[model samples]
Target: MKILFNKPYKSGNELKYIADSIESGKISGDGIYTKKCHDFLENKFGYNKALLTTSCTDALEMAAILIDVKPGDEVIMPSYTFVSTANAFVLRGAKLVFADSKKDHPGIDEEAIETLITSKTKAIVPVHYAGVACDMDKIMELAKNYDLFVIEDAAQAIDSYYLGKDGLKKPLGSIGHLAAFSFHETKNIISGEGGMLVVNDEKFLKRAEIIREKGTNRSAFFRGEIDKYGWVDVGSSFLPSDIIAAYLYAQLESLEFIQDRRKSIWNRYDNAFRGVLDSKHDITLPFIPSHATNNAHMYYLVCSSIDERKKLLAYLKSNGILAVFHYLSLHESKFFNGKHEGLNLKESDRYTNCLVRLPLFVELGEQEQDFIIKHINEFYKKK
Candidate 1:
């Protein structure tokens, strides 16, 4: 009866991995298993170079460092993302240009992005929330046309894909010049606390390596390749221990199963709540475009308005379901105000008010799902 995030976290072989790390005596960072995980991601996903980091926030900070963000440099992103999306650039003193979300979802609106660009605009951080692929084609088109750097915040987008003009589906993180991933316990996989940065461009790979190594040329040095690797540049200690990577590797080896299990749960929720799709035009389910194949990261409901959504939240929590809400609009957050004054992000505001995220994880059983659905349906009936 405890439908607590029934996720099958990294229990199997995690202790063994840690034990091995201890025996190896190289448990600090970037060991053999780190290389194995890095190789798996590169070969499996087509990323040119992948660097394991402490968290998605660390990877994002690495991207910000690579971009050399500074005061007056503007980084555009949606107002609906986790604060880490904007905080990464803000740490480097970059100006934030917040854009509205799309008419249908929380992903950034492409039309809105173009309008926000100016000479001071240096980068675009497109967060693919809920593992759903944002309109990458349109975003890429804008990047090329405007000569802007693209940093994809693929925190929830592991197996998700987008169909390009070639008609073949491209992996989510592989397409962007730079992408960040999260392997936090809350995700489909659990590494306890870890993340990665994927570098797509050949030119950026060298700099990325140095940044991950505390601003040194140590990566080359480790290869018996360099004479001396010193404090070569400005960087931070972003790498995670090989112990965490080993656990992540075990979880990744079962990626297909994890994805399949989560997908089944997502379908269950979608089917049980199917009738609510058209219950009222104002209250709708997630509308995914044909081109996007999400990783089943989250399943949420969009209600009629802010107040209606709030009432449902109270009802669900009161019933012990642990249902939660999503991000408050970042543009209106305490940190950044006044800078982007005329930036009225309407869809972001709507999502901030109406979106209610339900729990989704591997091992969410039929009874648990039924109870959740039962409560949800009951609330709608009384409403």
Candidate 2:
């Protein structure tokens, strides 16, 4: 049996919605389907405003623009994240200040953020790695103290919650000043390639829409708030077509079903490996902090060494199961090494070399998962 790392699950209504969008005679950005998507996200997540973008990269770029990232401005974020996180700020000529991952989790180390802040710092980006929440309380406090903006890299954090000290649960994307979410085929909720930007601070609400529509007040014009719209600020055509939103809306309608199944699959992987791998001293399981809710975006394990990870991946591939590794540390990457201040990001490097992701999609059957689990156990036993 051949097993791929990821397979996009269809919610059964994607084509139907897409056809409806095509028949509507207006398949451009912010059409009827697009409005439905924006309403669904805002109402369900309690986000102040939600705008669908062509991709998460676009959403992040919009965020970079909203925060007014200028040359010489510093934006601190984890090194163990996708390049898009840093690239958004980099495109604005902002200096990237790389932070390390947590000792127990792949998410950013909240405790290490303050020291990275300086007079030149303009923003703090906290990535919710693998749908696990970062410590927002500490991060927010730090941002408040320093008067910095917080742009959440929540690409994998849809349907996840962060439990606060006040005993209230806040959605991950709604906590930060601005947040970006991805609907890449690999994620739990997919639209082939789509994303959304959540504007939590009202200050950026109007400007966010303008930036998304190529620096024009078109969104307002569509709402009858303006008679004419034209170039007003630096921006881009970041919004996705209504066709993309139509596909996304179908998935959103089945969000609960998708989330529940994914969580079950995640639990199966966790239970299969937990105590069973206790003897494997070099392996570390996924860790979810008490304050974070699991969205089961993906299941991953961390090997103690790069050699072990490489061997494990090869073994899985040989077994016809295509498990994969993730992310190289950005601070040491060829493009950013010269810009880095030579700080030791050991945890980031550790995750870079050791992390391996397993297959955990909604459609992965019990039999297939059992086969994968059995093979993994067999391989570790022989080690």
Instruction: Give the per-residue lDDT of model 2 (tens digit) for 291-377.
Output: 999999989989879998899899999999999999999999999868899479999999999999999888899999998999888
Model 2 scores a TM of 0.99
C-alpha RMSD by candidate, in order: 1.4, 0.8
C-alpha lDDT of candidate 2 relative to the true structure: 0.93
Cα-based lDDT for every prediction: 0.86, 0.93
lDDT per residue for candidate 1 within 83-187, as digits (tens), equals: 989889989999888989988788888778888889998998898888888888888888898888899999999888888877988988888789999999888
Question: Model 1: runs farther than 4 Å from truth?
Answer: 5-8
Alpha-carbon lDDT of model 1: 0.86
